[model samples]
Target: MQVTTATEAALLTSREIITGEELGSVPLATPGAVAAAARRAAAAAPAWAARPAAERAAILSRAAELLLERDQEAMDLLVREGGSITGKAFYEVHAGAAELRHAAALATGPDSPHGPGSEPGRETEVSRVPLGVVGVIVPWNFPLLLGMRSVAPALALGNTVLLKPDPHTPLSGGRLFAEVLADAGLPEGVLEVVHGDADAGAALVQAPDVAMVSFTGSTEVGREIGATAGRLLKRVVLELGGQNAFVVLPDADIEQAASAGSWGSFLHQGQICMAARRHLVHQDVVEAYTETLARRAAALRIGDPYRTDAQIGPVIEHGALTRIAAAVEEAVAQGARLVTGGRMQGPFFPPTVLADVTPKMAVFHKEVFGPVAAITAFADDDEAIALANTSDYGLTAAVYTSDADRGRALAPRLRCGVVHVGDQTVNHDPALPFGGIGASGNASGFGGRAALDAFTRWHTLTTSSPARAYPF
Candidate 1:
C-alpha cells in the first residue's frame, strides 16, 4: 500500500479514559489501505496454508506465551484506552491468551474426512479447508479478547487476515496483536492490522480478496455489514448487542443473588453485551434483593482504574456519559423508582439501581449499556421466564434458585445462547461457544469448535475403484 503524505493522512488520538489526557496518536488507514491489506493477505495465504498444521499450532502457542509475557503492558493499555477497571483489564489479557491457545489446539485438529454414502464402486469423503482471507472488525469493549477471538482462529486455520479495530481503540485492539505475532515469528503479511472508521471496515468487507467477514459490535451496525456481505456473496459471522436478564427466584438466597446481580450489572461499568441489563426478581424476595443491590451499588468506589480500591471507572467519553444519564432520567420520569444511584459524576457513571421498572420503560426494554440495573418484580416462575424472554436479544441469561433441577429445566426454555444456573450473566470461557439468537446476533457462535467451523469450508471428493460410465 502506498503511504499517504503526512497532510493527507488522518490521525486517531489516544487518551486516558479516566483523565482525558492525550497519550499518543496513530495515523488512520484509509479505505484504499484496507483494500491493499486484503490483496497482500490473499497473496500470503497460499504459503501459510501449505505449512503443516503442527507448525501453525506451534506459532500460535508461542504467540499465546508472548502475550502473557507482556500482560502488564496490555493490561495498562486496556485500562487507559478501553476504560476498563483493573480486574476487567486483567481478565481481558488472560482471556485473550486463552483464545490464542484454543486456536492453536484447533490448528492441529482439522476435522477428519467422513464418508457420505455407500454407492456402488464409489468412495466419497468430505474435508474441511480454509477460506483464503478473512476480514475481522472488533469493537472497543473487550478489544483484545474480541480481536483475538477472530484473528487467532482465522490465522491458525491457515487463512490470512485483515483486522480493523474500532477507531477509539486502535492501539490496544490492532497494534498489540501485530506486535505479539511478530515477536512470535509469524510471517509478515499473514495478519495485517488496519485502523479507521466504518469506511475502512466496509472496504475490508467489500474487498474482492476477502472471502469472509467477522464482526462484533452493535445490532444496528451488524445488520448493515450483513446486508452488504450478503450482496457480495461473502461469508459473515456477527456477534451483536443484547439486553440480557438476571432472574432471581423466590427460593434463592437473597444475599447471594444480590451479590451476583451487583457484579452482573456493574462490572466494567456494565459496558459488556452480556451484562445483565434487566433484573427480574420474584415478588416474594424482590424487596430484599432490591435493597441489597441498591446498597451495593451505592458502596462501589468509582474513580481511575489505576487506584487499587477503584471498582468502577469512567465511561468511554462525555457522549456516552450523557447517553447513560439521559436513559436513567427518562426511566425515572416514567415512574421507575431510583432506588439508590442515577447520577453521573464527570466521566464516571456510578453503579445505579432502579426498582419497579416495568417493560414500558426504555431502560427495561432497551439495552442500557451502562451501570444501570433496572429491576422488575415477577409473581412466579412462569412470569420470570416470560420477562426474561421478552427482549429481542437472546444472549446469555442467569437464573438463581436453590433447586438445581428447576434451573436445568428452565434453561432450555430461556431462548438464549447460554444460561448460568447460580451465577451471573457476564461470564466467558474460551472453550465455550458464545453468541446469541435473534437481535443479539445471527446465531454465529464463536470459540471452541465453532471457531473452527467459522473459518473453514467443507469439500467433498468422490473416487471410483474402476472406470465407470458417466450419465451424460
Candidate 2:
C-alpha cells in the first residue's frame, strides 16, 4: 500500500464502523506532502495529454476489469470498515466498475476536432483540453463510486489526478481504490492518494498546480471549499448535501410509494446525500400511505452488516449514530409521532418514520442524514409545491404518481437540479448531471460528461479562408 510511518503528531486513525474495533494507523499527509504530490501530477499531465485518446481509454477499460476481479474483497472491506450491507456493497462494486467503463467510452469517442464551419470564409475549431491537475476530494459515504466519477473521467480525458479521501475512511474506501488502479498499469504520479483531514483538502484546493477541485461532501464543507475556489477563480465541481423531498400524489400506487419511500429513507442507514429526508403526501391518501410505509419500514432487518440477509446496517460511526438518535428523540418530543423502528442498539438505527412532523421541528426544517423520514400531509398541489420548495437545498426531488403526465407536471414546481417521475429521490446515473442548487451546489451545466467537462476548458480556433476567390 506504500503506507508511510505514522508520526506521533499526525496519526491517521480509523475505527471499524460495524464492530467498533480499532484499525492499524497510517501517517497523515501534511500540506507540503499534498503540494509535492500535486507538483508531481502537474509534471506528468502534459505527457499524458499527448497520448492518443484510444490509448488512454485502454487503461481505463483495464481498470474496470481489475475492479471486477477484486469485487468480493472490496465488498468485504466496505462492510467491515464502511458499515455497508452486502447488497449495498455489491452495488458499489459493480457501480464503480460501470462508471469507469462509461468514462472509457466517452474517451474513445471522437474528440470533436472539426467544430463548426462559417460561410464568411472562416472556420471555428472547438476542442476539449485538460485543466492541468484535478484535485478530487471525496467523502466517507460512497467513496469508491464518488471518487471514480472524477478519477476515471480525468484519467480517460488525459488529466492527472490527486485524490484525497476522507480521513475517517482511508483504507477500504479511499486508498484501496488507488491501489487497484495502480495494479492496472497506471503510471506513478498519474493517480496518487493522500490521507488526512481538512488541512490536506484545503491544500489541494489552494495549490497552484491543481487547476480544479472536485469535491463531494456536506453543504457546510462545500460552502467553505466553494468560497475558496470562487475567491481564487479556480475551477471546482461540488456535489453537496440534499434535503430532498419525495412527493406522494393522490393517484400514486400506495404500496409502490411506500416501498420506494422506505428504501430511499433507510438505505445506507440514510447517510446518503440525496436520501429523501422529507415525505410530502396529498391529504386525501395520507392515512393509507403512512400506514403502508410504516409497515414496510418495520419489516426491514437491521443488525450486523456482514449478515447475508441484513437489509439495514449501522451508521458510519458512534457520533453519527448518536446524532440520529437525538434527532429522533427530539422529533418525538416536539409532538411528532414515532411510526416505527425507533430502537437504537450500539451503532445500529433501524428504519424510522415519523408522522405529524411540523415545519417548526428540526427534522422537518433541517437536513437529517439518517434513517428518519417525516410524513406531512399537504391539502393541495399548491401547498405541496410550496412545502417542497421551502427547503434551502435543491439537490434532488421526486414525485410519485400513477400517471406519468401528473408526475411530470408536479415535479417541475419543486426547486432542485434532478427531478424524477414515479421514482425515488435517492437515485443517480453517471450519464445524468448530478448536482444541486442554493445551499446545495449547482451544476456546471455540462450534462452526461460530469468530471471531464467540469475539469476541462473549451477553446475555439479560427482560420480565415481568403484565397477562395476562384469559386464561380
Candidate 2 lDDT score at position 351: 90
> Local distance difference test, per candidate?
0.89, 0.84
| The 10-residue segment with the lowest total lDDT in model 1 | 1-10
Clashes in candidate 1: how many? 0
Which numbered prediction scores highest in TM-score against the true structure?
A: 1
- Could you tell me the lDDT of residue 22 within candidate 2? 69
TM-score (all chains, Cα) for each model: 0.97, 0.93
For model 1, the superposed segments whose C-alpha errors exceed 4 Å read 1-8, 110-113
The digit string of per-residue lDDT tens for model 1 on 1-472 reads 1123467676777777766667566778888888998999999999999988888889999999999999999998898898888889999999999999999999997585575767877788888889999999999989999999999989999999999998778778988999999889889899998888888888988999999999999999999999999999999998998898898989999989999999999999999999999999999999999999999899999888875568998888788888899999999999999998788898889998999999888887788889999999999889888989888999899999899899888888898898999888998887888889999887755888888789999888899878688789
Candidate 2 residue lDDT tens string, 94-201: 888988888888887766555476567687778888888999998887888888888888888889999998876787667777778888878888987888888899
- Tell me each candidate's RMSD, in Å, in order: 2.3, 3.6
Residue 256, model 1: lDDT of 92
